[model samples]
Structures are given as structure tokens and as C-alpha cells.
Target chain A: MKVLPYFVILPLAGSFLVIFIDSVLKDRKVRDTVADILANVIMLTLFILTLTLFGQSCSYFVGGWRPPFGINFLLDGLSHLMLVAVNLIALLSGIFSINYMSQYTARRHYWALFLLMLTGMNGVLLSGDFFNLFVFLEIASVASYALVGFGTEAEELEASFKYMVMGAVASSLVLMAVAVLYSRFGILNMSYISAAMPGESFDWLLKFSLFLFITAFSIKGALVPFHAWLPDAHPSAPAPVSAMLSGVLIETIGIYALTRVIFNVFSYKSILLANLGVISMMVGVLLALGQTDIKRLLAYSSISQVGYIVLGLGLGTPLGIFGALFHLINHSIFKSLLFLNSGSVFYRLKTRDLNSMGGLNKVMPVTGATSLVASLSISGLPPFNGFFSKLIIIIACVQSGHPVLAVWAVIGSVLTLAYFMKVQKLAFFGKLKEINKEIKESPFFMSASVIILAALCLATSFILLPGVRNKILTPAVNAVLNPTNYRMMVYIK
Target chain B: MKREEKNRAPTTELNGMSEIVKTVCNWIAGFIFLFGCYITAYGHLTPGGGFAGGVILAASFILIVLSFGKDKISPLLPRKRAEMIEAAGGLIFIFTVWTAIYAGASFCGNFIFKKWSCANFKLLSAGFIPLLNIAIALKVMAGLFLVFFVLSITRVILEGEKLKMVKEE
Candidate 1:
């Protein structure tokens, strides 16, 4: 508990430390190495620390002030699960960046911004109040905006601007909703808000604020109509950044934050949310089918997968929530792997267009294999983790007498497979491009990151086991199922 | 009278101001910088805190750059040194938090001299707020100046090239 906030503090320190070391050191090699080591160490440390918080539920108040008076760091099953996914992806991306980012200038600033983004994600997960959530969300959003334009090319700038505009609008909506909630209840802590929200007067003001939340969070999550920025923004960023953005960043601020609010804070699942989820799922996959850029395809697929989670959550059943939570972790794993695979291809070939490349497996065995694994996992092939979660969601749908949703979900899954197979065939398995004769396998670090993720793609199936499920996924399911338990021990005056 | 006229001659550039504005700017820049420091250092006891003071200090530098042109005054506060200052400020803040934790308090906990020593509301009364304020001030001051400096440099290069092209033609 004493070390809880360091999940946020360490990354903040690491970012500054990277910049400081760069300024002090004259040798570029030494600076890069030190920055790489520091970034990996920070992520690794946070990973271990977050794991230590597993199986325990506690809150740490900043400055030792009790909740309702001062800011508190809340750790429960849901945040703990998110912490694991965020830190794990960050660590892998940090390693992958070691070799990949060497091609870019001002590696120091890149590392600094990366660390700041991690700090923001961790802070978002841990903070127990609404205002802090907005602040951390801004931190993460600002860093991502800079990162998407890290290349500083014309298209990159355009994409970043689009992302930033949408992000700012969403943030303002969130702030207004927070203000409304505060005006209604005179409180900012989520637990207190949840405790007080149950009065019979779930009135127009409250409903309006909840509607604002749905709009704000849906925009952040990139649900259907709100998702235009994602395809452009995710593809424009550098590869590791693409991996983080497509993999964990959207899920953290978008899916995770949205669900946490609707599930716990609002403690009510609207039918509208469910319909939006179905639309996102169908629209995202269909739009993804026409994409040639591997990263953009993966980005669209992220929206589709997120739709599954939201759809499951919107069902408002134990099995639906379970499936949603399970799919969240599985999606983080495979989608990041897929993005990293795309990054590797981009790194070696210097292009993201799938049509321009062919037969990469002849030169890049590890990338080819890992991406194949990712492709399989995401397509809901048997034995990979995606299958189990998708199966559970389908089961939940059928059990809840929503076979139509289950049918659309099956259609979405089939579309997912078709697009990924298209990606694999076009980019990896056909005749080697005559101009791409010199393409080489990615370095050890990049390969290692993907291989580990791909391995976990198959390995995470253990989560559905009774014992493992009870320890990790079940607690989170319970946390989401019971919003009233959020007030645990933090006596609300 | 001839020597006085020479001393009062206007600057060379079309956009630059006359000598009086430049001289007044140079004179007030130091006061602005000092006043910024005064506010940041006593931020614990006063209303004007680190963020406000830092912006003021950065504005003083921006004023000098604007009046004298970036080429003349940037040597005193170059982008390199500004980035260094920004990083150092961040380091100071996180280190302070780390020390608080190392002393068996929580992160951001105030472990330094907790109780006020006297009845007087001295500048050093707070345990960590002043220190944190100074660090934030340094970061904000350097960071804002860097942003101004970089944007100005880009504009200079673009416009300077056009000027060179006109000269060549």
C-alpha cells in the first residue's frame, strides 16, 4: 500500500530522469543506452509492483488525508487488472523501442513522452476521484498528441490535430459532466457519488449528465461515428507508439474508463450503450476489410474488439461482464502483439502499405511467426485466448436470450478473421517483392517483445481455469458487478 | 549632438523598435525576473505561487527576445540550457517525493520539518510546498521559454530564407 502511488510516480520520475540524463551526457550512445535502461526498468518495476497489489483491495490517500477530504488512490480488482495490462504493454513497447527509436532523432524526448504517457495511464487507473481522472486523461492525451506527430510530417501533424481536437471536445464534455455531478452531490470521489446516486430521483439533471458521460466516453473509446480519428491517428504515430495507442491507450482511457463510469459510477447499463456497441462492432470490422495499411487495419479491429467488451458489459449479466472483462485482457495482449508485428514490418521494410510488400517470412521468421500467432488469436481460432473469451461472450448472449446479438457477434468474428487473413496473406506469405530483397528480421529486442506477447496469446487461456479465474478475473468481474462495494471501508460522510 | 544622435539611432530591421523601447525592455527584464523569483520563493506564504511566477519569468525572457531579437539574447538563455533546467526541475520534484517515501512517509508525503518554528509566517514555514513550488517554477519557466524560443527560431529560418531569396534576386 505504501508503494501504490509509485505505479504513477516512478514513470513520471523516469521521464524527467531520461531528459536530465540526456542533457548531462554528451555521448549519444551512452545517453540512448541509459534512457533505454531507465525506461525498461521503470516499466518492469511498475509491473512487479502492480502484481504485488494483486489479491488485495486498498486505498492510499495522497498526503495521508482521508477520503472525502483529500485525493485517494483506489485499488480494486478492476484497476489492478488494468494496471497489469498497461504496465505489461508499456514494458514490451519500451523494449521494442530500444532498436526502433534509434532511427529517430531526439530519442530523449521520445522516451520522456512515452514515460509521461505511462504515468498518465497509471494515474488514471489509480485515482479515486473524477477531477483527477480528467487531469490524468489530459496528460495521457497530450503526450499521445505529441507522439502521433513525433514524425512531424504533414500527414502526421494533420492526424495529430484531428485526434487532439476530438480529445479536447471529449475532455470538455467530461469536465462539464463532472461539474454537474458535483453540483448535484457536492462530491468528487467516485465511491461517494455511487453511494448517493441511488435516490429515487434519478432525475433529468442526473440523466442529462449520464448522457453527457456516454457521449464523452464513447468519443474517447472510438465507437463507430466517433472512431474516424483512430484510423488516421494510430497509423501516423511511430510503430511502438502505434502499438501502445491501438493496444492499451484506447482501452485504458476509452473502454476501461467508460465502463468503470457506467458500470460502477452510474451503476446502470443503458440499452443505448448496448446498441452503440453492436454498431461499432459491425462498422469497425466492415471498414477494416478495405484497409491495406496493416496498422490501420489493426486500429479498426481494436474498435471492433472494444465493441465486444462494451456489448458484453451492456448486457448487464454476470456472464456478460465476465466475458467483457476477460476479452479486455485478451484483446490487450493480441492487439498489441498484432500492432508490434506491424511495427516490425514497418521497421524493416519502411512501409505500412500491405500491397507494397510480399513474402516477408523468407527474411523475417520471428516477426512472421509471431504475427501469424497474433492473427490466429485475434481471429478466434481454437486454442488461442481470443476464442475462449469470444466463446464466453457468445454463451452469455445465448444465455441472456439475446441470440440476435450472438449472431451479429458471430458475424463480427467472421469478419475479423477475414480481414486478418487478408493482412497475413498480403504482407507475409506471398512472393517476395523484388525490391525487398534486403529486408531483414527485426533485432532481438523487437522479436523478443512480440514472441513473448504471442506466447501469452496462447498462454492466457489459463485465466478461464477455476483457480486462476478466481484469483485474477473473477475479482474484477465481481468489482464491476457490485458498484456499491466500491464504498468499501472509505466511510462516506 | 551628433554623438547623441548616433547613440539614439534606431535598430537595423524594419520590424524592430527604436532605441528607447529596447533600452526600457532591457532595464525592466531584470526586475521582471526578480519579481518572478520573489513570488516563487515565497509561494508557500503568498498567493502568487510557482506556476504564476514561472510564467512571469518566462515572459521576461520573451520580452528580451522580442525587443533585442532572439539572436542577441538567446545566448544568455539558450534552448539547450532551458531544456536542462526543465529536466532538472522535474528531477528535483520527483526526488523530493522519493525522499519523502524513503523517510517512511508516503509518496508526496511531507517528511521535512513539519511544525512551524515561530509565530511569524515565514517563507520557509511549509514542509514541502515551497520546495515543490520552486521546482515547478523552474520547469514552467524553462519550458515556456523553450516553446517561445523554438517557435521563434522556426519563423526566423522561414522568413530569413525569403529575405535571402529577395536579396539574391
Candidate 2:
């Protein structure tokens, strides 16, 4: 409980500390190494700390003020799960960036902004109040907006601008919803809102605010309807950044927050989430099929994969929820692996266009092999993590008597396989390009990061085992299923 | 007369605005800055806090920048120095929070006032609130000034090279 604040503190401190070091150090190479080492150390420490947090459910009130009067940091099943994912991804991404980020100037700024973004995500996960969540959301969003344009090229800047505009709209909606909720209940703590939700005249107002939340999260998540910025924004970001954004960020802020609000705070359910999920699934994959740019295709596939998670959760069954949570973790691992693979490719070749490359496996064996694992995993091939989660979701759908939706999901999975196979064939399998003979493998740090993620892609499928499921995924499922439990966990002294 | 005119701040490209405007800005900016300090100090008892006061402090500096142009102000408060100040402010805040652990209170818990009571309604009455406020004020002031300086210095070309590029396009 005492350690909760450090989750926010360490990263926040690391962010400025790097910037300070950057100014102090004269040698650019030494400065970059120090920043990289410092950032990775912080991330490693946090990831270990998160592992220690498993099976714990408690709340740490800031300044020792009790809830309803003071802000709190809630570490329950849901938060614990998110903390693990965010920290794990952050750690890997930081490691990957050691060599990858050296390509860009002001590499210290990248480390600083990256740490700041981690602080925001961690803050969002632990924050027990609505307003604090919004603040943290802005912190993460703004860092990402700056990072997207870190290249400072015209196209990168334009993409950053587009992302910023969409992000601003989403933020405004979030603020409006918070205002509406505050006006009605006069409280910003989610637990208090949940406890006080059974009143009369403000029910419609509550629904309106909930609508606003869904819309806001939809935009942030890049669901089909509000997804204009994602294809542009995600692809424009540096590969490690793209990995973080596509893999962890959308799920953390978009899916996790949306579910927490709807399931826990409001205790409400509608077919709306399901509808959005299905549409994003179909549309995202279909649009991805035509894309020549590898990163853009991966970005679209993220939307599609997020659709699966959302769809599973929207079913409102325990099995469905379990599948959703499982899929969430799996998606983070594989999608990040895929993006890092793309980054490695881009780092060596200086291009993201799939059409320009051929037979990359001959030279860049690590990237080729790991990306193959990632691609197969994402395509839901048997023996990998993605297959289990997709299978569970499809089965959960059928069991819940949504067979049509289950069929739609299967079709979505098949389409996912189709596109990934296309990615592999075009980018890795064919004859080597005439001009690509000089291309060497990515640096050690990049390959190691991707290899670790690829291994985790195989390893995470073990989560479906009964013992592991009981220990990890079940608690998270229970947390989602019982909204009232959130209040109880927070109030536990 | 020539010596007096020279003693007066030169109205070169570096020195901005009319003599009257520069004189008024120089005279008033100090008072505005003092007022901002007062707001920050009394934040615990007053409506205006660090953020509000910091903005005012930034406004005073910005006035100096407007009256005395970039060349005049940049030397006095360069971007590097401002950034350092901002970073120092943030470090001070984190240090203060960490101090709570040594003071045997929770993180961000009030250490000073809780340990030794001061008279109510005094500047030192609130436990570490003033310190936090001061830190925030420094950070915000430096941060905003840096932003203003950067923006003010930015040269957006709507003509010349950009127009030529547009024509080429």
C-alpha cells in the first residue's frame, strides 16, 4: 500500500531526471547511455514491484485522507492486471529503444517523454477518482502527441496534428462527462458515485454521461466510427512508440477505463459495446487488407484486435469476460511484438512499405523469425496465445447464445489470418530486393527485446491453464463481474 | 543631453516600443511581480493559488519581453536557465514529498505543521502548503515564460521561401 505512490513517483522523477542529466552532461553518447540505463532501471524496478502486487487489493489515500474527502489509489484485481501489462510493455519498449531511439536527435527527450507517458498510464491505472483519471489521461495523450511528431518531418507533424485534434475532442467529452457526473452526485470518487447511484431525478443525466464516456473512449480506442486519426497517428510514431500506443495505451485508457466506468461505477450494460466491437472488427480488418504500409496495416489490425477484446467483454458473461481479459493480455504481447518487428525492419531498411522489401529473412533472421511468431500468434494459429483467447471468445459467444455474433467473430479471425499471411508473404518470404543486399540485422537491444516478446507470445498461452487462470485471470474476471466489489475493496481498511 | 539620452535605454531594434511604454512597463512590472508573490504566499488562505500567481508572474516577465525585445530579455532569462529553474521546481516538490517519509508521515503528508503547530492564519501556519505552492509557482512561472519566449521568437513565414515553395507545389 505504501509503495503505490512510487508507481507514479519513480517514472515522474525519471522523466525530469533524464532531462536534467541531458542538460548537465557534455558528451552526447554518455548522456544517451545514462538516460537509457536510468529509464530501463526505473521500468525494471516498477515491473518487479508490480509482480509483488499480485493477489493484493487495497487502497492508498493520498495524504492519509479517507475517500469522499481525499483522492485515493486503488490497487485491486483490475488495476493489478493493468499495472502488469503497462509496466511489462514499458520495460520491453524501453529496452528496445536503447538502440532504436539513437536514430533520432535529442534522444534524451524521447526517454523523458517516454517516462512521462509511463507515469500517466500508471497514474490512470491507480487513480480512484474521475478527475484524476482525466488529468492522467491528458498527460499520456499529450506526451504521445508530442512523441508522434518527434521526427519533426512534415508528414509526422501533420499526423501529430490530426491525432491531437481527435484527442482534444475525446478529452473534451471526458471533461464534460466528469462535469455532468460531478454536478449530479457532487462527488468525483468512483466508489462514492457507485454507492450513490440509486437516486431518482439524475438517472437520465447519468445515462447521458455514460454515453459521453463511451464516445470518448471510442475515439481514444480508435473504434470504427471515430478511427480516422489512428491509422495516420499510429504509423507516424516511432516504432517503439507505435508499439506502446497500439499495444498498451488504447487498452489501458480506452478499454479498461470504459469497462471500469460501465461495469463498476454505473453497473450498466447495453448492446452498444457489442455493436461497436463488431463494426470495428469487420471494418478494421477490411481496411487493413488494402494497406501497403506495414505499420498502417498493424495499426488497423490493432483496432480489429481491440474489437475482439471489447466484443468478449460486451457479452456480459463470466466466460466472455474471462476471454476478454485473456485476449487483452495476449493482444498486448503480440501486437507490441509485431510493432517492434516493424520497427526493427524500419530501423534497418529505412522503410515501412511492404512492397519494397522481399526475403528479409535471409539477412535479418531474428526479425524475420520473431515477426513470424508474432504474425502467427496474431492470426490465432493453434499453439500460440492468440488462438486460445480467440477460441475462448468464440466459444463464450456461442455459449451465451450469440451464435451469429460468434460466426461474425470467426470470420473476423479468418480475415485476420488472411491479412497477416499477406504481410508475411510480401515483407519476408519472397526474393530479396536488388538494392537490399547491404541490409544487416537490427542492433542487439532491438533483437533481444523482440525475442523476449516473441517468447512471451508463446509463454502467455499458459495463462489458460487452470492454476494460472485461477490465480490471475479469475480475480480480474470477478472484478469485472461484480461492480459492487470495487467499493468494498476501496473501503477495506 | 547626449549623455542622458545614452543613459536612457537605447531604442534600438533590441529595445522595443516607445520610450513611454518601456518606462511604464519597467516601473509597473516589479509591482505586478510582487503582487504575484503575495498571491502565491497567501494561497492557503486565499482564492488565488500557485497556478494563478504563477501566471501573473509570467505575465510580468512577458511584459518585460514585449517592452524590451528578445535580444534584451534573452540574455537576462535564457531558455536554458528557465528550463533549469522549472526542473529544479519539480525536483523540490518531489523532495518535499519524499521528506514526509523521513518526517514519519505518509507520502505527501503534512510534515511541518503536524510536527509543530504554528499560529493559525499566518504565512507559516499551513504545513508545507506554502512550500508546495512556492515550488508550483516557480515551475509554472518558468514554464510559461519559456513557452511565451519560444512562441514569441518563432518566425512563421507566410511569404518569401514558403511562398516560393507553394508556387513550386
For residues A132-198, write the lDDT of model 2, one tens digit per residue.
9999999999999999987865678789999999999999999999999999989899988888887
RMSD of each: 6.2, 5.9
For model 2, which pairs clash?
none
iRMS per model in Å: 12.4, 12.0
Error of 1 at A118 (Å): 0.4
Docking class of 2: incorrect
Give the TM-score comparing model 1 with the true structure, all chains together.
0.94
How accurately is candidate 1 docked according to DockQ? Answer: 0.29
lDDT of 1 by residue, B1-169 (tens): 0111112222234244679999999899999999999999988787888899899999999898888877766579877788899999988998897788777666677877554444447876777888999999999999999888766544211233231111100
Give the Å error, residue A221, model 2. 1.1
| DockQ values per model | 0.29, 0.22
Best candidate according to DockQ: 1
**Global lDDT of each candidate:** 0.86, 0.88
Worst 10 residues of 1 chain A by lDDT: A484-493
Residue A475 displacement (Å), model 1: 0.6
Q: Tens digit of lDDT per residue, candidate 1, span A1-493?
A: 7777788789998898899889889898998899999889989999988888778888887876776767888888999999999999999988999988867877889999999999999999988999999999999999999999887656787899999999999999999999999999998998888888864458988998988888888888899889989999998998889889888898889888887888888888665776788899999999999998888888899889989988898888999989988998999999888888888888888898999988999999999999999898888998999999999998998998889999999999999999999988998899998989898899999999999999999889999899999999998998898887787735521
